[model samples]
Target: MAVNLNDDLEFVDDDYFDMFEFEDEGFEVNRLRREGNSAGPDDVEDASKQKSDTSALEYRKGKDMQGIPWERLNYTRDKYREMRLKQYKNFQNLSRPHHGLEKECKQVKSGSRFYDFQSNTRLVKSTIVHFQLRNLLWATSKHDVYTVQNYSVMHWSSLLQRGQEVLNVAGQIAPTQKYHGSSPRPLSRVQISTMAVKDNLMVAGGFQGEVICKYLNQSGVAFCTNLTDSDNAITNAVDIYQPSNGSTRVMTANNDSYVRVFDVERFVLLNRFPHSWSVNNTSVSPDGKLLAVLGDSTECLVADPQTGKAIGSLKGHFDYSFASAWHPDGRILATGNQDKTCRLWDIRNPSQSVAVLKGRMGAIRGLKFSSDGRFMAMAEPADFVHICDATSDYYCTQEIDLFGEIAGISFSLDSEALFVGVADRTYGSLLEFNRRNQFHFLDSFF
Candidate 1:
């Protein structure tokens, strides 16, 4: 199957046409090696390792933690960055002038150091099934991270410097507990497209519209089902949030132009919201009163969470939106678009956006707000991840430069660490950045 672009998989770009071509060969080699002994993504050692020693978090100060051998690649870091800027193409469904909002954006300065680079671990290679979907990585705490690696959902630990398979969808999956309104048959060879982890509950959405829910503390699959049977039925996004009623819910945005909410406890369908366009992503407000829906349309809808009624519409985006995030304060909403921009909107006045942020290259595939509401991280499709100061109206930012396609960006629940997943075959690894503060020294003492 081809990578789904434009929500309906109607558009295809050459950049990602050969993405899945290299997976089968790699998977077969790794499968045979795993039968003999345990081997992770960090098991390989190349001649470049003799040049400079690097490991997950075992490097001395001032050493290159990423271990990228620019000399071997025959291109300097600066030269490659320039090449990507000129050659990388941003996928777009609509041909519209992009310079209109560029004038309104402020010249964002990039010297701010809110988070400092800590380490990079090749122990777990992050992979994405869909090129446009990027919510694959999730950090439950400063030490634990969950990401997709081929056919398995792998969990990596910064403290242990090792990884373990959490869920494997390479075979068949059936719900452990059956409930009403469930699929009768089990799903085999499921390919996960998007995932979200929160409050000990992890929900993964597949390309075949399969919703698989698992609890980190529990064993085996908690619940699993195929959400839609349509030919174009792809689960684009999954979000787990607790509303004001204190009940846990899972919301899935599907290419079938519907957002389905499920009760977590019973694993039963609660409500379904219909949309005019394919819903790429949906986010409920922190208070659980409002919902932000983005998809094939340029405008994002702010609706009542219960009824899914359109209370307001945010206009100004030039292309399709793939990501949406809400601040903890519940007043600000950030939407990422294929137009290579992320716009911040104020809920009180939905007439226009408060700020417009541009990307280095490619589209803004993911947006994340720190749990403390202190910072916001925006990720492009590759190489660049921007961290902005949410308290300062997003004027100051720190651009993290690396070489790889970004699988996802996630902030730890405590807001102490930021994790970036690189999906490249050569530099495929997980990068870590610790929150910079005066109390950081206290961690060493502990």
Candidate 2:
């Protein structure tokens, strides 16, 4: 759009395009002067005459709200039209996708099964899964949803519950874009199976796309450029990684071909590593030295992140290595796949399988090693999250029904807690495993 800080200003949006008129400048001055002269000097009142003049002035002013002189109204109109055109152009420029030039890039299908890392031990029995959607993720609250555009407010007093009795409520909500930002928040970006939020930052990584680092501001919601595009240096271009620590940092993963360390605030890319196939998932090692990347295309390669050389290819899963994880000590790597079996590999020798975890027939997608590295939690395509002994193969001793299709699961930093994604809602859950080793619903935050 055109910028005019001067008295004469013009702004145009794309709503009306072909209506602009073209005229040279001198014509505008002469025309305005002519209109001024026709109006004559202001006759201070002949009450009736003044009334007529006032009426005419009001009508004229209404036609020139931008405050441009009557004759220049046409020029202003054209300026507005041009402004609109420019805005449209600007939108187009921003909408175009930047072929992300993440170094050593490889493309992979986003929902590939290569993200789960399972452990079979004599530990637990089952696990849970949650998180499913239509508009993706705009966490629904109570009986209503906060839409993308309408950040409205509703009075909390507005309802009731009728049972053998009845239900009622009070108050109402007023939805408006008033508190909204310059753009509508995206309902979804790449499916970030895990979103790690710490302090003011939220890091997401999952879908076979870019990991996004979202910086929160005082805005009504979190602040980040979003899935659309990046201007002014904020966006979803970086591959995000959330180590056990809550601090948010984005890794560089473009396509699936390469992986690199990325600094969120500066958008700087560093420490690039090439992958043999498109990466299904990137997990930071518990020790923080290794980055485990699960790949599916043809050969799945695991390499020393620092050296950028292939350590070896994990061979076990028939179709693809759907899920994998590194032991806390960083000595072992475990993988789950579409065939419904989980394999354990020793990183020192990736070519051999030390153990096989089997049970379910469908995909086993979620995996977690207890903070003590003594127990493991694994979830299948079903509703259970299984707790297993990490030392022994497939040694599940207990289980918990997450009550929905399992999407993701994790043990908290202290192993005292577990988070499971609920399929029917956008917001996942925070469940605590008490000393009795039972899962407790953490509903206080709700």
Candidate 3:
């Protein structure tokens, strides 16, 4: 076939060789043949055909894994990343300066700025299932607070920056004594409806017409007694009072239409006063001479603590009253009513209310006054608490948004902090607010 190699290898233009090349239309067949499919002309074409089929199968398989489309998998990954980023942003927002911080200040209508301090949200793990906070009290020591929910009394300590549950006193019935004849069964459960704390003593009244007293520093119950004949009776309110000349006493208002006074030392029934309607709340005067009582009626009654005699009545509320608070000087009284208003009464003028403070929503359920007689706080059923300045005729005020069912409110004995109790399953908390003032003259005197 090759007679003379030099004669066949003649010089030719490079453009002439380029014109003889073929364009690839199917899977670059000739390139695959050169790489691995080296065979005769007919076999080469068949192998190229088979390789093209396999390449098409692999291309389709690359579009998905485990029957899911590539587009869908990318979308799921993007969504998860977005959710995680959003969660991180929310956590960062909580740490920023907001209304719930202790040093945050709010501007009032009068252009005066005041600081609204809030502690960390406290959660009672054991009482999370209960949706109602029946009563609340601040201990003589300003660092502790108590709450009554269902059959348990919870003690919260605020010694640290954040408040936490320290102790819980759960009610239990005593075993019946052996008797010759048949005896009735004692109550198996007692639901505490009201509570009061003084010094080391804690007294709670139950819905089963029972009163249980316990010592805060001790373990066991101090005393337990059934105050009413019927088991269905409710103790609406319990108050601890210290007279000037006598020892400490406990006063209770019950749904059985009676107010009873008990000696804290002896746990004996001292006196009982029968009222026309069920008493909802009662507060003894600071002088220990008169008692301010609120009941089912619109009028609030002033009674003698020693004799239980009705001295006079303060009228003017449009609806039934639920809570009452007395001024530190014993000259003024505030009664909260279902009419969404709190009425202020002066003992000197028993015929009419001195002032009426309105709420945004729901009835007024709780009332408290600072020990210095400077501020008065009224709590509505849900989402609102009003702190009014008593020195200005309650004209200057600040509203605190709690955003839950408010069970009770109390001011510290030193007039430094205010405590609010929220009674919700998910949002239940004890909120503590500090009073920030620029002046220190009164603080030095105290």
Candidate 4:
């Protein structure tokens, strides 16, 4: 029940729109125009200055945070949203009734702006390799962000307003460090499907079941390996975390119906947990005792990390789930589904979800909880990201409406900055938002 982008298949859906092709055409047109109108030194300098001015981290009172000029585009915001909803097709592996999903959803209270939009910059363009995957972006700090752009993993520094290439997977890359039990073969042109960066270590999963690891402080890739030899192999998600034993580890969910764990230091396999369905995503609890496994089934399982024993099962979703996250307190768990809803469950109760949050127009592809456990963010497939207040039982929320497919979402370690990746060729950029706290008063004093 997993979708393989490597297959060449025919489609029959009425609303099937080639959005990626459209975006590519737009990018080509822009490139040709820029080449035709070659500017002199003065014009080039002025253009560069203009781009810098727009890309800076500035907050204007009445301007749109996304820099989308709806009035001048000959279409209103509402009309564009209507068109998207009518044309957008949600991908599903299982046939089910989707029209009745709204009946089970709870309407979230709107107009609570806990985070203010700080900037929208086109300098750092984020690209998506697979449309169904949205786990490519990560923020190591408030000023540092990493995302996929074509074949490169790019690092963008908000403080300096510049970008640098962290790792280029376009060329042949072989692991420099050799492990005893791991196969060391040169991998070329790996199509990365998902990635995670934490505590100076970055790990990326590929469409061909390759796991690539690199240290930010080091020069080259530390380790690389292919997890499976199956034809339908795809690494769906990668989670980098520390266990209770204080050892760093990496967990990956794959389309092979296995959740594989690897020791970070030795780059060796630690454990492999088999599931009934193709595992889409996995998140370990804060205490590192419990694991949440979600995939092609409507029911999600709570399992043990060390042993592959099922602790409990949560059932409420009518469609497959693609994303999961644990609150810092390790009590509440959130899972995003193709049913256009994100369900929050209390692990202690495990009977039903405590809250059912609905999306605006599409599937909830990504979810993240702030480090302080104060806010939870849910991202749709495109054009919507919702921030829910954790203290208010998730009733109060703020909706961030934008244009483009979301590559991913991440919160800084300090819970001060939120970064969203937009993957459209024309409107592709990284969006940053800052928490609305009283600490900004100190900025004026400085």
Candidate 5:
């Protein structure tokens, strides 16, 4: 005797798409299997009869699925929308088309808010970025372009009559400009690594953004009014240095995996060298022909400036690179990294660091060759700065009183002065070294 079991397997549950709860149907199947109410392995042999039974079952799946508990599904899509909007609000507000104030700060007037910082000894009170009322021969220029003026207000009575025409060191200074009051599209990027400020021309670059140039010497007559983005871009402008090509040629390295050169005047795309991973910074050779790019990927790249072609890529830094500079002679490159050390390399065989300068606990952030190339100053985020001789590859001398993380540094063109920009809990100021070989605080320019 054959017992017919025809209506147990069908797919018509209304809440089928909601796989959240399948418990009710699971219980039904178990009960039927245990009580012998549904087909077992023996039911498939008679295919013709099974077809009729399967059709009847298809029409009754909901009947079997009824009374299943409907648990509510949980998920919301609004929280993500709120986060993205807040991240982009501040940039939108500050970028509301230039309000046309002073335009770009061009010629900083001698005594106005727009002149050079007069480091005169006569200034009864010395302030950072400015001198006091009676002492300032020329006020610091609000314009980013600085004037080369060396004058002493107190010695005027003696030198003023000695058959001498007043010398404005900036008599030959000229701004790099394309047109008058030319404003281009503003960019999303604000901070840039390298800034080339000469005469009245200022060019800056940032990570994965366009290269930008500003004309700041128009006195009140501003030229490039807006920051225009360029096609030849960088990742972070992580490291910026200029070669002495006699023209303002800015070399930049970005985290975006490349080193680029920008022609400031035309704002032209000069050259690009591909560097994968994060490039720490770039150092231009003394001859202005070679550039050394230290990579966070553990390598140093030496390349020809004119060709954007790599002479070689060498691996030396044990860990991610943090800082680097060119030797005074241009044949050697030096690199610092998160590994807590600095290393010297030969451009020809950059794969190996010839010497290691060690001591810092944190990654190095600042490195600069002294004006005479006799020494290189290596700085970390700590309170002290390290000084190493160009000839000796070790930490020969140290200055312990330096404070905060050394964020940036430079030597005066004359090599007679060293300038350091530091970063601490609050905004920091500069440290100065003068001809008297005396070290002092640079009047903070803020």
Candidate 6:
């Protein structure tokens, strides 16, 4: 009657009790008493059969898990092998050059083998003897190039080696005979500020805000008009917009804080828009819908070309911007600043610049993009002209040293040659450089 409970519980299996053990282990006998009262011999036998069936299923599952997936593993291995094979083929193709490519490369290397890389000099065919060359305009026909200097227009043939001056038109034309009655005052000399040419029509802007039009082949003037009433008006820049199916329009930026548009063929004023500050430079977008303008302010503005309404503003430069150029595609703009940097802006996102190009010496006085948008030339106040490869995200840069002030820069319509106008009095000359292709990787053979 006094037997220990631990000895009486020896009928329970240790492993079976261990499976049910928890940290707060305690036994309640109410469920076991109820089950013992309700259970019969047939119910106990059925419970034993269910337990046997569950154990058989668990054993089958474990056996299945022990086997490997041969088909799936084969597929993965085949895919990896195929990828490696492709990589090997690509490497073979790149390692060896083809017959045609090898021949072409040999020809190129032999033809340019004698090229003087150290000197980097070409024969000087033409020398523009004019001093203070302010602007250059290349005609559409590609036969004539125009330059402005000292209130005179000099026409030169593009094919001329010596650049023989074809025609020289002075700023003033004398009257044939003095009038007997009271005669009008003779025209004063025009200090040319800007020039533009399209087809055979040439237009020049004067320091006194005069726009003069002349025919490339004719002698006398075609039309002339004063764009401003002030006696000391300065025309900062002139641009010609020739739409596909419309008349040509002349756009002029003036020191009087206004941009004027005129019909060149009709000789009539079209529209004039006023600005808060003096407009230093203006460039019409390629589509002729927008105008990129640099002014006395630190920020550049884009405006409607026809109405002169301000559309947007690009702000990044710390000093006043004096020059601007548009990519041929018309989506990008380059603004030259007095801070010695040219900021390139994406018109789609006018909030910030896409890149900032720095120069060596003074303020950027001139900026021009090649007609094909392959190269961009930025001229500083003196001694430095930077030619950037626009097609390369502006990574490749070529500098030209002329040892003088840079008046302006122009590229031939085909972009095969570049012309830089040096403004120094003693060394004033026009420089021509033919663009040469470079094979930089071949240097390793040395």
User: For each candidate, what is the lDDT?
Assistant: 0.83, 0.39, 0.62, 0.82, 0.42, 0.58
Clashing pairs in 1: none
Order of all candidates by lDDT, from best down to worst? 1, 4, 3, 6, 5, 2
C-alpha TM-scores of all predictions: 0.88, 0.48, 0.68, 0.89, 0.51, 0.64
Q: List runs of model 6 lying over 4 Å from the truth.
A: 1-143, 162-186, 243-245, 438-446
Question: Using alpha carbons, what is the TM-score of model 3?
Answer: 0.68
Candidates sorted by TM-score, best first: 4, 1, 3, 6, 5, 2
Q: Once superposed on the true structure, which residue ranges of model 4 sit more than 4 Å away at CA?
A: 7-63, 98-103, 439-446
Tens-digit per-residue lDDT, 125-177, candidate 1? 78777788889899999999999988789999988877899999888887676
Tens digits of per-residue lDDT for model 4, 66-181: 55545556677778778887877777666777666666677778999888777777767776666667998999999999998877899999888779999999889987787777
lDDT of 5 by residue, 1-446 (tens): 00112222111122212323333323434554567756564443232122211121232332111122323223222332243233321111012232321232112112111111222111011111100000011112221112111220111211121112122111122223344333334343222333334344444443224445444433321122122234433333322345665776655555456666656555445676776665546767777878666664656677777776778877644566656777777777777665556677777666566666664344555676765677676665444456665554442454433323343445555555444443322212334333333232243321
Comparing 2 and 6 by lDDT, which wins?
6
**Displacement of the residue 418 alpha carbon in candidate 3, Å:** 0.8
RMSD of 4: 3.9
Q: Over the stretch 1-446, how does candidate 2's per-residue lDDT look in tens digits?
A: 11112211011121212232423223434444566754333322232222221121343336221112436445554565454334422111012232322221222112211112211110111111111111111111221111111111111110121101010011121112222222223333223333433344444432223243444333232322232132211111232444444434455433335665654445344466765544444556655556666544423567655555765677655544445667788887776554555667778877767766653324455566766787666666544566666654444345553322343565645554444433322112222233233222232222
Q: List the candidate 2 regions with Cα displacement exceeding 4 Å.
A: 1-194, 197-201, 205-210, 215-249, 252-256, 391-396, 425-432, 435-446
The residue-level lDDT of candidate 3 at 337 comes to 74
Better of 2 and 5 by TM-score: 5
Minimum summed lDDT over a 10-residue window in model 3 is located at 1-10
Report the lDDT tens digits of candidate 6 across residue range 1-446: 00111212112122112211122101122333456877666565454333222121232344111111224343443453354334321101012223332222111111221111111111111122211123444434333455654446665554542243433334464332332331222345655667777667777776666777666667666666677777446677788886444768878888788888877655567788888887878888888888888877878999888778889999877666668899999999999876667888999999988888776655676788888898888887555678887766887677764444455677778766676654433334455555565864453353
RMSD of each: 5.0, 23.7, 29.0, 3.9, 30.7, 37.4
Range of the 10 consecutive residues with the lowest summed lDDT in candidate 5: 127-136
Worst 10 residues of 4 by lDDT: 8-17
The candidate maximizing TM-score is 4
Clashes of 3: 0
